[model samples]
Target chain A: MSLFAVQLRREWLLLVQSSEEILNPLVFLFLAITLFALATGGGPDTLQAIAPAVIWVLVLLANLLSLEGLFRRDFEDGTLEQLLLKAEPAFLALTAKILVHWTFSGLAMTVLAAVAALILYLPVSSLGTLLISLLVGTPALSLIGAVGAALTVGLKRGGVLLALLVLPLYVPVLIFGAGAVLEQMAGIETRAQIYWLGVISMASLTLAPFAVQAALRVSLEQ
Target chain B: MSMSASLSVSQSLKAWWHKLGSPRWFYEISGPWQRLFGVLALVLLVTGTVWGLAFAPQDYQQGNSFRIMYVHVPTAIVSQSVYMLMGAAGLVLLVWRMKLADMVLSAAVPFGMSMTACALFTGAVWGKPTWGAWWVWDARTTSMLVLLFLYFGLYALRQAIPREETAGRACAVLALVGTVNIPIIKYSVNWWLTLHQPASFTLTGAPSMPPSMWVPLLINVLGIYCLFAANLIGRLKLTILERERNTQWVRALVREVSA
Candidate 1:
């Protein structure tokens, strides 16, 4: 197989061996959704009204929580430096790493979000929109979060700093992602929101890898 | 002969930019500029404030509360421009590895942060009289809030990293990333809502308000830009001195000044 495939397999193996990396964000998502329901007295009417916002916010937070480990382990083991030192460019390796990150955190969260939505009383009609919005939106989140993770990965206490660096960038994504679901529930056209979300995701897919690579280089220089 | 002349002109332009990239050169050249900008800012600001607050006609709609526009509009306008300035500095730092560009980026942050805060505060105070609330989720207001958060992100990131050059480079990446997202954030937030009034001045049009109003507003804008420049240069000189304290020239200059 090729080098990209080799890197992909390596990241996959590493994640599988340490499955809790996948479980932590998933647990956070489920628990937060349940607690939100309990705290709000589990009223269907109120929960349904705010379900989209709650789910989207939780997903964004869970994605951030997962990001604290995205590059930290690799950096600690010196794998990141070795990967960057290769004769081949690091973009493909970085892409594999981000893809694996999204698969475990963003994708898994989207699946759990459907369950969370049911628990929160989101209308069945809005379910498809939520799923589709998350499908398109979370890749951009992973990409953007990787930029933050790479920048702070070399720091001793980078977890909180990562959130501060990445959260402002997450605003547009949250606005449209949740806005799309909210619009669908209100019987408005959601095409614009989804389209904007797609534009953001595609833009980040193309741009964020270069930024992540630059950040990693900066981190390594120290 | 014309071709050689054009080539020489380009070479000279390149030389000028390279000279500007030198911290020592900037430190030496900016002393008089800082004084000039300080004097100009003071004169213009005082004239504009008195003209705007006292002499200008009260808004038939807003009464005297309209005078706060003299502060709100300029700070709001300059705050965004400073972010753009830092973004440009970030580009220069990343692409050319210019140390002075990093200094520019670092020095501008606190000033820009305060300007953003001043704009938001003035906006809230203005809003209390106009919108009947101190804060509203209006498009302009929300976007300015996001701008404040972006500034904080850069500030916190700079503080988190211990090594100066590493921190500078990392902040450069973050600043560039923020710059790219700024237009998207503005567009998205604008699409979300727009209760804030349209701009008073546009490049393609004459003043929407009377010249009596816009003239003072224009003066305040110019005054604030001068203040921003003076502040940036002063902070930059201090940063250069601190960073270069171990160098021979800086020591000599310190001795010369103290003696």
Candidate 2:
């Protein structure tokens, strides 16, 4: 197999073999959604009104939680150094890591977001839109968050700082993702928001790996 | 023959330029320019603020509250431009490994954050009487808040890293990344605001201020630019001294000043 395929397969196997890594964010998302429901008094009307935003914000936080360790294990065990030096361009290796991260975290969060949407009383019609938006948006979030992870992996206190660095970049995604579901709720056409989600994901998919690479190089140099 | 001739000419030019790249030369050169701009900023700001506050005609609609625009509008403009300047400086730092660019960036972050704060504070104050509330998630103010967060993120990232060089490179990447998001943040916030509010939340839509009113605003804008320049250069000088304190020229300059 090409090294790229091997790297991809290896990453997937690692994630699947360790079930806790995949389960944590899903559990966190569920608890956060419930907490939002409780905090707002659990009224069906209120939950319905704020469901889209709550889902998006909580999904972002869940994504942040998962992103915290995206590179920590690799860095600690000396795997990251080998990963960097072994790859030719290093871009593919870096991107493969981020893609695996999305599969484990972003994809899991999308499914949980759909379930949370139903629990939060989001309209039945909006569920598919919510799922679609999350599917398109979460990969971008993971990519941006990966950059944050790469930047801060060397620092002792990176958990909260990671959020600060990543969340601002996540603003546009949240705006449009929530907007997509909200449009469905309002009976408006949902095409523009979805299109923008695709655009953001494409941009993130292409550009963020370079940033992630730069960040990793800096951290490792330090 | 032509190519070789041009190459030597460019090499000589680059050699001369390299001398100016020294922090000491920058310090010495910026001295007079800083003084010139300092005086200019002070004089224009005093003249413009006094005129705008005490003399300009009241808005027919907003009344005296409109006067705060002199401060709000200028700082807002400077805040965004300073971020873009940092991004440009980051490009230079990453490509050329210029220490001065990083110093300029380091000095600008706190200033940009403060400018963003001033804008948002004034914006809120302006909104109180006009919009009947102290805060609105209007596009402009919401996006300004995001800009403030971006500044905070960059500042925190720089401080969190232990080494200076590593921190600078990382900040350059973050700042460049943030620059790309600035427009995205802006447009998305605007879209979100309009989608939610569907009302004309703009304060300065019409150019109805007649030159008597706007000319003071114009003066304030010019003054703010001068102030930013003066402040940036002043801070840059201090950073140069701190970074180059070990060098003999800086020590001599320091002794000369102290004596």
Candidate 3:
């Protein structure tokens, strides 16, 4: 438990200190939303029609953009090797790192999702479902994305490759998250989809760490 | 008497498992299987494809185009099975550190990939005649595309790493991770397809397909399985050769072949 706390604190320190890492994705979120709005000519219905898919996709993209390099810094400086050499399960440290990265990317994007909702002129009624779905879904993104990040950390340039590796796994999360928003938009009760998103969140949280742990071990050995 | 018989069976099984773990032992043993399955595949595939293509009666609904099912269904089933086989191989490689298991896992991916491509192409061609478009967002095709991507990622990853051992381990973890996605993709696509379009085409709409139709399909499916096995063993032998090139066993085998 104390080890987990220490790991959390260390991740917290790096996360808060890396302001550029945090800002870049937020800016990307903003730019992508704006560019999409401009491209669609700001038609309210079309924007609203596409808002669920658009917002969720951009959030996914932004989360991925942020996570692409989440572990490279640690790996380069040999922190990963030292951490792996320790007696404790490396998954605890990995979970903490992913949680911090999720905070910076997925959690932040959920909050920004509402503002983007407004920008896209989504009906105010659907905002609650949108936020809830992103909230439930994004942790899975981080957990799964961390596995991809860990696997690719040994590659000198793994950004594009990491995206390729992880994006397909994100489909269920996208389907449920965006599907919930679309449900709310269509006046259907979204309880089922939201529940499914939560299930994914819990599943990925518990399962992805093992994959991440093994992947990190392999990468470190390489 | 029964107890003694079971004891010997168990002991032999253990011996077989250990021998299978060694590349040298595996290479020595698998030659007969390679040739046998290769011949079986060649014979069965030719017969099945020809039978399915020319002999099967036209589908009352889809006409001659429904013939693509012969290719599509088999490739689809085999591709999924191939992924499962790779996952199982990944498990063995990771747990047992067996070189033979890793060889099977890596050697089998491209065949699995091409199977996915063939399924997708046949699906698309089948779609054009039936669904009226080159592509549709139906769950099966989408999931197959994703399957293709996972293979691409695994293949690319294996290529990216410099060392063979590290590449194998990384692919092991990745292949296992990808296995988790397969069932999820399967069910999600099922639900998605049902939600989007109810009652899509079936292999044979009738409760039981007549022998004229499904016999050929079954033959093709079994033939493809044999072909997949043949290709996998052949590739495994080649991989064993390349990886074991410096070993004395391999050197002797090479000299034996030359002689």
Among the numbered candidates, top lDDT falls to 1
- iRMSD, per candidate, in listed order: 0.6, 0.7, 1.0
lDDT of 2 by residue, B131-227 (tens): 9999999999988999999999999999899899899989998998899889988988888886899576779866676888999999999999899
Report the C-alpha lDDT of model 1 over B1-259, residue by residue, as the tens digit.
9999999999999998999888899999999999999999999999999999999887777788888999988999999999988889999999999989999889999999999999999888988977788987777788999999999999999998899999999999999999999999998887666322354312213326788888999999999999999999999999999999999999999999999
The Cα error of candidate 1 at residue B82, in Å, is: 0.8
Candidate 1: tens digits of C-alpha lDDT, residues A56-164: 9999999999998998887888889999998277888898889999999988888888888888889999999999999999999999999999999999899898998
Estimate the TM-score of every prediction: 0.96, 0.96, 0.96
**lDDT pick, better of 2 and 3:** 2
Per-model tally of clashing residue pairs? 0, 0, 0
| Model 1 stretches with alpha carbons more than 4 Å out | B194-207
lDDT computed for candidate 2: 0.89
lDDT of 3: 0.87
The window of 10 residues in a row where model 1 chain B has the poorest summed lDDT is: B195-204
**lDDT leaderboard ranking:** 1, 2, 3
DockQ-derived CAPRI band for the predicted complex in model 2: high
